[model samples]
Target: MTGSVWLVGAGPGDPELLTLKARRLLDEADVVVHDRLGCASVVQELPPTTRLIDVGKSPHHHPVPQDEINQILVRGARAGHRVVRLKGGDPFVLGRGGEELRSCREAGVACEVVPGVSSAISAPASAGIPVTHRGLSTGFLVLSGHEEVDVDQLAATAFTIVILMGMYRLPTLAPALVAAGKDPLTPCAVIQEAWSDRQREVRAPLSQIAVESARAGLANPAVIVIGDVAEGV
Candidate 1:
């Protein structure tokens, strides 16, 4: 009675953003291992029979470590339960789906990946800013704000820069860009909780994004867009 595992993307913050396959998998999953950023509506709708495991992690804290999460998935499958590793954003895009996938394979558990819309593009669009706009930007770069960011590389690129999990680093992001040769007046926008009711945005010059974002009291689960397309709100 051994079961299988699914690495499903829950999309940004909105439940409606979920793919049909993701919804179908959720309905069939006997166990769901979710993150803190996963949509509440989706989690709340799971049948009472569904076993929910909250392995949500934040920048400063991780209630469930990665090793434990991997073990939980493998153990659940071995016990004959359909397991779903529910993550926010696309599983491959900074969601750490790769590690979990490798874990399942090593444990001899069958696994499948279902992709979802990434917040890197969705968050900016939620604010009417395109990551790449004809003359505005021909390309874009997505980076992690939770770890070491190469400010010099960022300053040298004209490509639109989208940074995820950057709220805590906002205070230094802009100043570093300036020091690395980026224009102080470069347009920047911070989108908080994209596609949800709590969604809010802060638009400012590169030099002022930190102060403006602070004034707005923007918190985690945010996307920071830097480019001409994000200018003027």
Candidate 2:
């Protein structure tokens, strides 16, 4: 009688933003494996009897590799424990929830995904920037800034571009967008620690966003919004 695994999204750092289903799963899970960006309040609210496994990873630092995380989930389920893989933001949106699900299925473990609000939209909205508006933007693109994405190609799109985990890459990304024909004066905003008490935002033109962000001493765990929507126009 193998147990099941639940891949739960912790939303954008706000405990209250957690979905009812996610909260219920957290309380009922026998073991919770969480990431670094998970809501602190929710983690603290876990029942004392629930086991916790911290697999948090920082940029360029993976203390618990993804493979190990998958193995941990498989083992927990095999032991007949209700396991929850809690991730920041929507698990499916650049959180690698799909990979974890595949791992579970391969191991014959039943898995479920409880989606939560993604920072791609929630982060920008917290700063009063809608990802899309009637005339500002008809649609938006959500991308991970953790890799070598093609800013040039992305610049050609009319949709608002929301970049997650891109604070560190802004230096190159901002310039690339400008060089790729995006208006140098296009508005951009960087929201840090979205939905948290220490949340802050920095707005600038696409060409100067990297400089402004540097001047503000912005750190990781931030989202970057590029295009007209960032100006809240």
Candidate 3:
């Protein structure tokens, strides 16, 4: 009676951005395991017959650990329930979808992945900034805001840099980039609560982004874009 698992990306915080395939899977799944950041709107529209489970994790507060989440999917599938692991943005893009996919496969369950639009690109777009442009930037790099990164390596590249979950790190990130030779006046924009009703944008130069964001008191569920293309209005 083994069932299957689908690692579906809910697409940023906008249910409207959800792909048709993702929507179909959600409609058909017997159980949906959703996260806090992404699936709030989508889950609200789920049919009552479909069971829901919250595995949402926030900055240091994880009620359901990774190991536990893995077991939840495996167990649900083993019970012959079609388990859907719904995450915000693309599951592969910093969503830890790979780990969950591996867990399902290792446990002898079927698994499939459905990609979603990541805020890395959409967030900047929401702020009218493109991560890549003809002359401004030809490429972009997406990095985790929670992890330690090499400032020198980042400074050496001209590619646009996109940082997620980095609101609190803004105070140090901006200065480090400046010291590493990245232009102090590199155009930067932070999209807060992107795609939602409360969405807001903070535009500043690399050296002043920290102070600017602090003054605005911006919070997480944010995406930061740093590059010439981010000449935000």
Candidate 4:
């Protein structure tokens, strides 16, 4: 009989942040296929007999493409292995969990998603910035910084804007928001490696955050938050 697949979220690089379900699944999985951002401590918890596969990707470098990863998951399930597809942050929040789920179903595999805390919110929260607050932010928006997005629309929203994978594009993104009518002095912050011991953060106005982040030597895998909520503790 074929086995099942579980798309588990490892939760923003902090093992303690993992849900009980995710941790239990990790312990029970016969094989764990994980991404680069997965918590080291959590991955280390796997039994010695559990098979491991690394499919981590870096900016502009995909050592294992998505198609190949999907194939691997399908193959593992067909082989009757209880497969765990471990991802950093919430699988549904820009983790491509939906795509993987669709692939598994197409291949006749039984699969389930176990949600985890997303870095989009947790990163900023770790820096003491609330994404929303009463009378401050009524809502929040999350966007991927990897593609061309409309800064004008984003600037026009009343929601706090959170950008994941945005470190590399801060120069263009910051200026675009300003040009789109957002206040140049709008509060902004960048948080790197949130929830980890090496985590770092930088706060500044919208116009200067890109420059401030550069001075701090922030890199990818960081989250950028913009709006009044960014100014709050």
Question: TM-score of each candidate?
Answer: 0.97, 0.97, 0.98, 0.98
lDDT of 3 by residue, 15-133 (tens): 88999999999999999999999789999999999999999999879999999999999999999999899999999999999999999999999999999999898889887888898
The pairs that clash in candidate 1 are: none
lDDT scores in order: 0.90, 0.91, 0.92, 0.91
In candidate 2 the C-alpha lDDT for residue 87 amounts to 94
Model 3 off-target regions past 4 Å? none
> Candidate 2's residue-wise lDDT over 159-195, tens digit each?
9999899888899888888888989999999999988
Lowest summed lDDT across 10 adjacent residues in model 3 is found at 224-233
Better of 2 and 3 by TM-score: 3
Give the Å shift of residue 13 in candidate 1.
2.2
Where in model 4 is the C-alpha error above 4 Å? none
Model 2's TM-score against the true structure = 0.97
Error of 2 at 142 (Å): 1.2
How much is 5 displaced in model 2, in angstroms?
A: 0.4
